[model samples]
Target: MFFFGTFRHSLDDKSRCTLPNCFRDDLGKVVYATKGLDNCLNIYPEETFKVLCEKNAKLNELDSAQRRYQRMFFQTSFKYEVDKSGRITLSKNHLQIAGINKDIVIVGNNDHIEIWDKDIFEKIDALQNEEFESNAQLIAQTYKE
Candidate 1:
C-alpha cells in the first residue's frame, strides 16, 4: 500500500510512538525500521521489507561499495510489532541515529513511512519546495512513456 501524508507525533516517555491512523492498517502487525539515507528512520510493512531485502540481496556482492551499502543498511535495521494500540517502540540506537527525541514528523514516502526529528524535517522540507520543480522535471523525463 502506498503511504501519502504527513503527521506530527510524539514519542512517550518510554519511546513508544503511535503510528498515524491512516498508515496503521497498511503497515500490518509487524513492521521493519531502518536508518534512512538522510538520517531519518524508514518504516516498511512486513511484505515490503521482504521485497526490499530481496532487492538488496541481488546487489553485486563483489563490489566494495555495494557490499558496504548492504552492511550499513542491514546493520541498523530492526523489526517491530505494532502494539494493539497501533504503537511501536523505537530503539534507543534508532532514535539517536535519527536525532529524534520527543517530537517527530512522520512523512509518507510512497512505499514506506519516514520518521524525522521535528526541527530537522522542517529544515529539510523548507529546502524541498525550491528543488521540487527541477526534481519533478528530472523524474518525469525518466518515467515518460
Candidate 2:
C-alpha cells in the first residue's frame, strides 16, 4: 500500500518505538529495516522488501559502486517483528548511524517508512524546502508526458 504522512514518536527506555496505527495495520507482524539515505532508517513490508531484494540482485555485480551498495545494504539490514503493543526495537547500530535519540519523526515515504531524529529531520526538511521549487521543476522535467 502507498504510504503518506508525518508522525512524531519516541523510543522507550528499551529502545522500542511504536509505529503509527495506520502503518501497523498495513504492515504485518514482521518487517525489514535498514539504514536509508539522509541518515534515516527505512522499514519495508514483506512484499516491498522482496521487490527491493530482487532489484538489488539484478544490479551489475561487476560494478564497484553497485557491489559496495549491495554489501552495505545487506550488512545493515535486519528483520524485526512488531510486538503485540505495535512496537519494534531499534538496534543500537542503526540508532547511532541515524543519530537518533529518544525523540523521532516517522515519515510515510510512498512504499516504505522512514525513521529520523526529530531535530535532524526538521533541519533537513527546512533545507530541502528552500530549494523545493527548483527541485520540483527539475523533477517535473523528467516526466516524459
Candidate 3:
C-alpha cells in the first residue's frame, strides 16, 4: 500500500496515540513497529512486514554485517494491534528509543509509516527539503523507468 500525508498527534498520558483514520483503515487490526533508520519509528502492515521479513531472510547469515543488522532489527521490533478506540500504545522502551515524548509527527513513506518526535522531524524535514530536488534528480538518474 502506498501511504501519503503528514499528520500531527499527541501521545496521551497512557502512551496511546490515535492512528490516522486513513492509516487505520488500511492497516486493519495488526501492525508492526520497529526502530527506523533515522531515529524514528517505522510502522508496517502485517503483510508488508511479512514481505520485509522474507526479503531479510534471504540475506547471508554468515556475513557479519548482515548478522549485526538482523540482531538490531529483530530485537527492537514489536507487534501491536490497533485498539477499539483506534489507538496504539507504544512501549516505554520504544518511545525512549525514538526520543518521543508528547508531540509527534506521523509521515507516510510510500509503503510504510514513520513516527517522529516533532522537533526532531522538523529539523530532518528541513534538511530533506533543502536537498529534495537534487536527490530527486539523482534518484531519477540512478533508476530510469
Candidate 4:
C-alpha cells in the first residue's frame, strides 16, 4: 500500500490521537512506537517491526556496541496496539523520547509512518527543502529511477 497523507493532530492527556480511518485500513492489531531519526515516534506495523528485529538480531550481538544498541534503542521501544477507536495512548516516556508536545504531524512514510512534533517537522522540512533545491541535480543523479 502507498501510504500518503499529512495531518496535524492534537494529543490528549492520555496521549491519544484519533488515527485517521484511511490510515488504519490495512493495519494489524499491534503497532510499535519507537525512537525515530528526527526525535519523532516511528510507528511500525508488527510485521515490519519483526523484520527489523530479525535483521538486528543477526548482527554481532557479542559486540559491545551491539549490546549497547540492544539496551538503548531496542529495550526502550514501546509496543502498543491501535485500539478499536484507533486511539493509541502513548507512554509518558515514549512521548519524552520523541520530544512530542501538544501538536503533532501524522505523516505517512510508505512502509511505515511517523508522528512528529509539528514545529520540529516544519523546521526540518524547511531546511531539507533548501538543501534539496540547491542540490537537485546531484539528488536526481544519485536517486535516478
**Candidate 3 residue lDDT tens string, 11-120:** 99999978899988888799999899889999999999999888877878899999888877888899998999989999998899899989999999999999999999
TM-score of 4: 0.87
- Candidate 2 residues 18-68, lDDT tens each? 999999978889999988999999999988999999998888879999999
Superposed on all Cα atoms, the candidates' RMSDs to the truth, in angstroms, are 1.1, 1.1, 1.1, 2.0
lDDT string for model 1 (1-145, tens) is: 7999999989999999899999998999999999996779999999999999999989998999999899888998999999999999999999999999899999999999999999999999988988999999999999996
TM-score of each: 0.95, 0.95, 0.95, 0.87
Q: Mark the regions of model 3 whose C-alpha exceeds 4 Å error after superposition.
A: 143-145
Q: What lDDT is reached at residue 27 by model 4?
A: 58
TM-score of 1: 0.95
* Residue 95 displacement (Å), model 1: 0.4
Ranking by lDDT: 1, 2, 3, 4
lDDT of 3: 0.92
lDDT of each: 0.94, 0.93, 0.92, 0.82
Q: Which lDDT value does model 3 have at 103?
A: 100
Question: In candidate 1, which residue ranges exceed 4 Å CA deviation?
Answer: none
Model 3 C-alpha RMSD to native: 1.1
Output the lDDT of residue 63, model 3. 98
